[model samples]
Target: MAEIDPDAKRRPASVKELKAMSHPLRVRIIRLCGDHELTNKQLADRLGVDPGTVYYHVRQLVDAGFLEPAEVRTGESGALEKPYRSTGRSWWLSVQLEDLDTSQGFAPVEAFQQELAEAGPASIASYARFALHLSPEDVAELDRRIVAVIDEYVETDTERAHLPAHGGIFLLHRTPD
Candidate 1:
């Protein structure tokens, strides 16, 4: 059974928490564990890393409250194993990077590049990019619309067993003239 923490708090990530989650491997860990709880050994095998490395990052995520222990079970060796599940904080994270040093923001960009490099062009479902000049209000409105579409699609989808997992990156920034 999935463990539910009645006191699980959902709030914007603090700088400390963000830093904890800033590493690309950590982000991948969270994504891998999104649907199901996994042991460190399982995560390590999937991520192609050592279990010790995965365990280190998992501890950071659990400490940051972005993951929680789901259940304990027997492994192939008949030893106890603890699995963890995502807290869903990444889905609703609100980060204000204005006053903070934003070096950590590049983690996602790097992850995106790595995924594309691995998947190559053959696995791509869709790709599109647009360059637009607009006022601040127009930019805000566009952002809202984009987010709405993403949220609607994410929320409405219930049958994922037959669907392929998709990765998307939505980037909006003012270009230097």
Candidate 2:
């Protein structure tokens, strides 16, 4: 497997691309495509949504350069099908959610929640809950360190593709006191 260069700069997502990624469905679409090529119909089936709705989201991802058309292949029914694959562009793009409209900024978190619900508690491999008291700089440091560790795993992921796919999210939010 190829190693990643840690110092390489990540591309910043453009306003258009950011807008395209603002919806929870679109975020989920990106995650699904990242795992494997899927046609609009297949995505609709997996997402439990109408094909028409998935088609719109797929078109948006395609336009934003997050998803690309893969080679046409014969389906199980021996019918020709066109599928889309994640371009992996989102992994290399820096998206500053704070700069986006507040209502649109939580797409990834919302998508994660939906996916977790679908996966159910039985699918959880591990869980943790904690409370921390930290200054702004400490919080930033904690986030940076945790992200670096996750990034290392992400960079080396293809080496372990044969393993089962697992999903996770990390969040640190202020307590409502």
Best model per TM-score: 2
State how far residue 1 of model 2 sits from its true place (Å): 17
Model 1's TM-score against the true structure: 0.83
Inter-residue clash pairs, candidate 2: none
- TM-scores of all candidate predictions against the true structure: 0.83, 0.91
Task: Please state the error at residue 103 of candidate 1 in Å.
Answer: 2.3
Clashing pairs in 1: none
**lDDT score of model 1?**
0.77
| Candidate 1 lDDT, 48-101, residue by residue in tens | 889999999999999987889988998899999999998877766665556335
Q: Write one digit per residue (lDDT tens) for candidate 2, span 10-127.
A: 7678998898889999999999999999999999999999999999999999999999999999999999999999998887777675778965778888999999999999999999
Instruction: Give each model's clash number.
Output: 0, 0
